[model samples]
Target: MRKLSLLFSISFFSLYSFSQSGTMQYSGGKSADKAAVLIVPFEPFMYISEIDRQVGLENNLDGKAVKSEFAKALDLYLYQTFNEQFQVLSFYFMEDDVEQDLTYVYRSRKLEYEVLPEESTPKAEEKLKGIQTKLSKTFKKEEDESAYGGQIVTERDEKNKFMNAIISDQKVVDSLNNRYNASLYLLINQLEFRNVYGDFTQMEGNTYDRIAKVHYTLYSRRGTVVSKGLATTPFPASDNNLESITSTYFPILAEQIFNAVNMDITSTKN
Candidate 1:
């Protein structure tokens, strides 16, 4: 009887560990045929360092330009890498028609800033302008060391809650399933870039490593949550090295994201 009880305890512990791992596969046979995933591009939500230690090509760092380039490159590499295991569905083709206006929530934390949806209207654009001013002011006041700190864990949990609501919308799920027969859904939540050396107070020169965090969610066709986590990678920090960053670290981040979900599925099945 003790031996049997010990076995049962081991089983419970294994399942508990799986739940905490931030990756999961639907144990029930949801899609028996094959893997087909539809990826939503990253929303315009980012947290970046405001320091001038790392100089750009023009000796000025443009945060907007960096965000735009990284968003596009990350999306491309993600699709390419995941296509190896699944029939990747491109949502970029119909982006404008399906796109919703976004409202920005600025936070001085790593991956805590949010770009949530609002109705498409002139007011939305006006509101965004105000938010941009606020973000700029906040960034201007922050140093690299303390800018992305002072975050409570609940902040991220709340953002994930909001993300869950978006991904679990039945109407959207139904539309995608009907239109593309997509069995899996991937949503890029947010991204952040930070310099490796935290203390900018004693900086000698310009060179440093830049680390990126790509937060994402994966769900089943029925809007059942599969996995949600962040994939991170570091590259040589250079403001003018967008080409190198795209060609190198983007692929690494993509592969990390893919393996995060794929390995979970494999482990759960076995």
Candidate 2:
């Protein structure tokens, strides 16, 4: 009986570990002391999955509204967590002046990378749009021309879009740094909520585990880039709401992010 119990425990532990996976990638283990970091308002990946768009059409979903809510939740969490040492100051954006339009990317079991706009948009109107838009839309199938569209999303795209938005906001970052008495600025280039498979991947499977990825760049007060870091939850996918990802899985990732900050700041002597 004891042996059976021990075996069960080991099995469960292994499965738990296998389900949660993440990484922390950064450059320069240097430091930045007295760094009152400015956390610019978070941005979503300027992306809309075909599925999300259709669901929006059916359910009247507003991607920006959804993202705004997510941003608020995330900002509150970060403030509560990091305000002490870093003097974390957050900004909320109301208007965006970026000229580029948001694009949709189709992800599915077969494809493993981002499908370019020129590659996927036109077929959205074709019969077998989105998922059914064929491996290559050029080889149009006259029979399936009546099919509608669909879409899929991954964590990577969200991260990229968020990062790009901040990169474009360089004009304002310098001012914020000075006003906040910040020696460093922490901006999340990407903070996305997505479901991962129990297999720690999105390829296909029924296990709806949840995971999040955050890409941040720390800049000096003068706007000189210091370090870029990534922190992902070591949790599997779930049907849970986005807010819970931070409460449930972010402790570990948060620690890594702050650790990177300390490593950078503390390593640099006065």
Candidate 3:
């Protein structure tokens, strides 16, 4: 009898863990498949020291530039993944927004500027800016077709520029709902990336690694968070390089998140 009880306990926990792999607010069945989701540009957090020490990027400005490049790449990857699952509205400055850039993401009401270097050569500054521009243009060719089904609306009147729609605000939600009439607005507050050094038993060999932890909140038209999901994607030990590993696993991680959060709200309707 004791052995049977132990086996049952193990079986129960295995099922529970699989269900809980993707974070969910309230659970039961899946939500409407047609529900539109506004996916904002992913805000990124990367350890500066890791870039400088491990990646051999010494200049803080250069480190920040690399950080910016990764942010754009992550945004593109996320939009591409989510676009496949839901009708997505985006405020990604690199590919979508008309005027706003990183400055807008600083979000005026919550503005925090990076300190300018105390002393820097003009040549260095110019070089960094050049690299930034080049990297910005690199991802455009990757998209073979437009998922939005129309030419991207790029030309906007100046009066509507500098939209900080990337961050969650009642006004932003209301505006997007007014425009796209999207049912849910997903605000990704942070996509934290950290370097993992050395090998683990899962795969052998000393190598650098990374983990992408996405923290997101989903709001309804009433300005309430209907659901929240967090996805932490770790690189498989076999072949771990930041860019390559992320590209391979991000889709799977995103699918996991969608499965959990896309859960039918009907099950919890009161």
C-alpha TM-score for every candidate: 0.58, 0.50, 0.49
lDDT of 3 by residue, 1-270 (tens): 333234433433432221111211111223225556765544433121122223212222233443444454555455555555555545543323322433343352231212223331122223323322111121121122122111112221211111112234666556556554667766665554433433343225534344444555566776766655455555433343334544576665566556556663444464
Which prediction has the highest lDDT against the true structure? 1
lDDT agreement of model 2 with the native: 0.41
Q: Tell me the spans in candidate 1 whose CA falls farther than 4 Å from its real position.
A: 1-34, 46-63, 93-95, 100-168, 198-202
lDDT of each: 0.50, 0.41, 0.42
lDDT comparison, 2 vs 3, better candidate = 3
> Clashes in model 1: which pairs?
none
- lDDT by residue for model 2 over 149-171, one digit each (tens)? 11224323221222322233454
Tens-place lDDT per residue, model 1, 40-126, is 665453333332233233323344444444565676677667766776654432333333311111121123334434321123133
* Candidate 3 TM-score over all chains jointly: 0.49
> Which candidate achieves the best TM-score against the true structure?
1
- Candidate numbers sorted by lDDT from highest down: 1, 3, 2
Tell me the lDDT of model 2 at 249: 57
Better of 1 and 2 by TM-score: 1
TM-score computed on alpha carbons, candidate 1:
0.58
Cα deviation at 23, candidate 1, in Å, is 27
